[model samples]
Target: MSITPDKAQRIAALAKLAISPDQAIRLAAQMDDILGYMDTLNSLDTSGVEPMYTPVEHVSVLRPDVMRQDISRADLLRNAPETNGESFVVPRII
Candidate 1:
């Protein structure tokens, strides 16, 4: 799982990133260290441990969905400085 300079250069190219030769070498070393740490973690034993999805033990409480009266379009448009017949008018992006 070691990352070499050539592999790092290839990864940078594939990701469309511009990196110097010195940066490529440094990135490769860092990636190798990360992989080494992951490998070390993989060596740990967790045979009977229960997997935890969250730190706290509590059920999620959610309100039941119910329809409510909505505001009229004219009421909503009254506060806007600029708006179309059905929606707010915004500046063109492109």
Candidate 2:
């Protein structure tokens, strides 16, 4: 798999990237090398191998969900510039 500077420029444009002519040539060669490596990896036989759900096997440490009233709602809403008895007031939009 060989990549040309023209192909590199097209790839850069599609990715919304700005690259110089020299940079395009360099990137094209790098892309060709990567594709060649991918082709090598694809040739490996792994029909019996099971797919991984995650890289590492570990149980998640979760915290218990408990409701705690740290402060009153009236105290929190007191700082608002314009707030109704129940909630903060905002401009109506259609």
lDDT for model 2 comes to: 0.90
The collision pairs in model 2 are none
Q: Give the TM-score of candidate 2.
A: 0.48
Per-residue error at 69 for model 2, in Å?
15
lDDT of 2 by residue, 1-94 (tens): 5889999999899999999999999999999999988898688898999989787677877788988999899998999999987799999977
Candidate 1, pairs of clashing residues: none
Per-residue alpha-carbon lDDT of candidate 1 for residues 1-94, written as tens digits (9 for 90 to 100): 6799999999999999988999999999999998888888678898899998788767777788987759888998999989987889899978
- C-alpha lDDT score of every prediction, in listed order: 0.89, 0.90
TM-score for all predictions?
A: 0.44, 0.48
- Mark the regions of model 1 whose C-alpha exceeds 4 Å error after superposition: 6-22, 66-94
Over all chains combined, what TM-score does candidate 1 have?
0.44
lDDT of 1 at 68: 73
Per candidate, the number of residue pairs that clash is 0, 0
